[model samples]
Target: MPGERLTQQERQRIATGLAGGLSYAEIARRLDRPTSTISREIGRNGGPRGYRPQQAHQATVQRARRETPASARAAGAPLGAAGEEIVELAVRTGLPRMTARVHVDLLLSEDGRRTAAELTRRLRVSPASVSVAVNYLVQYGYARRERDPRRRRDVYVVDDDALYHSVMLSTRHTLESARAAMAAAEASGADSPVGRRLAKSGAFLERVSLEMMESADRWRALLA
Candidate 1:
């Protein structure tokens, strides 16, 4: 559903929806499509003000005809084998694909830092995409942003305690899950067989997470 092409009828409906001042999400809901599909269609097809469904459809046809070479085009410079592997691992750890790539790029940088523009140029993606990815990294405590006085630009720097923060994040989730399980156990009558199993599992997870947090804080203090 996500990757499917928009039908001509859908394009016409999108045009009508846009004319009716409907939001992308609303239009997407009407069409049973992802909001991103609507946004991208409008963005690439002369934007909201100039979007012409027929022209856009024709353009899509032409683009598809020319896509073989475009698909084979290298995504700028390769991130190197190790960097690529790390990016994949980061994605597996729940980071979004673009966010993981940006994080890995920062991690592989000389000083674990890069500006939004630098990221855009290196990643060969739009500035908005870089902004979103870096914002996510900063939000998760994986990185921080600082102003470069001379350049008058913000630079994203991977946190020196990123690993420690990562451990804490993992522990926090485990602890929360344990609490949820315990709550469910209580609701189901803790003396019941299933409730007892839930309680035991919850207790184990809770204890282990607390121990990990304590050890991590001690290690962090030692490193400091």
Candidate 2:
């Protein structure tokens, strides 16, 4: 409906289309939204070259928060549509739905950290659910757990390094898989045709993974 707000995904499409030199009408047509809505969104956020999807989405969230009443904030504000879109995007990247929600909430938090109790309060889930999701995040290096002695609780922390940590973890897993493939090939008779194919594929993966790690190290400072 025209009264509904634009989703984070719609904003992403607008950014992509704008970057690709698409006209407002074209972008609107693709989104099945009004051309005026597209025009107003870009105008308010940043025109053409200055537009960015993530920033635009965050701005929308900020606007909603600002509009919410202070009295209403005592119980915690809704995460908002933009925030939910962020959770959905995280889930699309292979995180389970609840884990993605917990992680994204931490990412969006003003302090980049939250206790299990705080998560349960805002997420409207049981403490046990928050504990399981947070454990998954901490175990996979997607987040860090810190003791908040002053608060007498553990806080789950997310930071810029969260993504970098996840990438490195995934690369490590790929390297292990490559080594396992080579081992399997040897056990299947190293002289066989299938064994040769497996060895070749494994060697390629191992080489690429090593090079990627080296390059990642060399350019790691860029993330800072």
Candidate 3:
């Protein structure tokens, strides 16, 4: 069922299931499909609130037709091991696979900028899917959105300081958590075993935050 396409009947069933307030997992169980399939189907079309079976079915068909040739071409031009490793690293650093793949694709592109349509054709994904991935990239500071003056389409530009921003965000979160932990430890009395453990954790996180800041400064200096 790896490459299975949902039938119109199945789409109707999914719409009905959503109307009846069934969870995605329950709907998937009824259809003998994976929950991710159900989730993707719903996500691609209007979500649970606005999903329409007929519309969803038609959209799916159109997407399949559009992507068929592109997918075939992509298969012939595989991303080498290095590209795959970049995607894997992004995933390990907390990006979803699709988002990470999109990020890496942008990073590898010659100009580091692409329109949604271009990304859709290159990645063999729907415009909606590319939009979702690009939105994620933009939100996390990995990419920026700009309007093309000559065209109506929006373009996504990869940020050169993407990794630095991501690390800085993480470092700030760690420092905040450490501060909260220290406050909790103090409130619980410093003599208690739980308080001592919390203090240790907070100290470690603080050190990590400091080290991250120092590293970021060094990298920024090199860039300058």
CA lDDT of 21 in candidate 1? 55
Question: Model 1 over residues 1-224: C-alpha lDDT tens digits?
Answer: 34446644467667656654568998899777999999999999988889887787767756753663543335624577787688656644445557777888888899888999989888888998888788767755778889999999999998678878867876776676566567667766889886787678679888998999999998896545
| TM-score for predicted model 2 compared with the true structure | 0.61
Span of 10 residues, lowest total lDDT, candidate 3: 71-80
The TM-score leader among the candidates is 1
Off by over 4 Å in 2: 1-77
Q: Write the per-residue lDDT of candidate 3 for residues 37-112, one digit (tens) a residue.
A: 9999999899999999788877876675466575543542334567768865654444555676678778888989
> Tens-digit lDDT track for model 2 on 1-224?
24345655567667656644568998898777899999988998988878987787778766765776766443323577777788656644445556777888898899898899989998887888788788878866789999988988898999877777876776775676566557656766688875676678679878988888887778778778
RMSD of each: 13.8, 15.4, 13.6
Model 2 scores worst on lDDT over the 10 consecutive residues at: 70-79
lDDT of each: 0.74, 0.74, 0.73
Q: Would you list the clashing residue pairs of candidate 2?
A: none
| Candidate 1, run of 10 with poorest lDDT | 68-77
Sort every candidate by TM-score, greatest first.
1, 2, 3
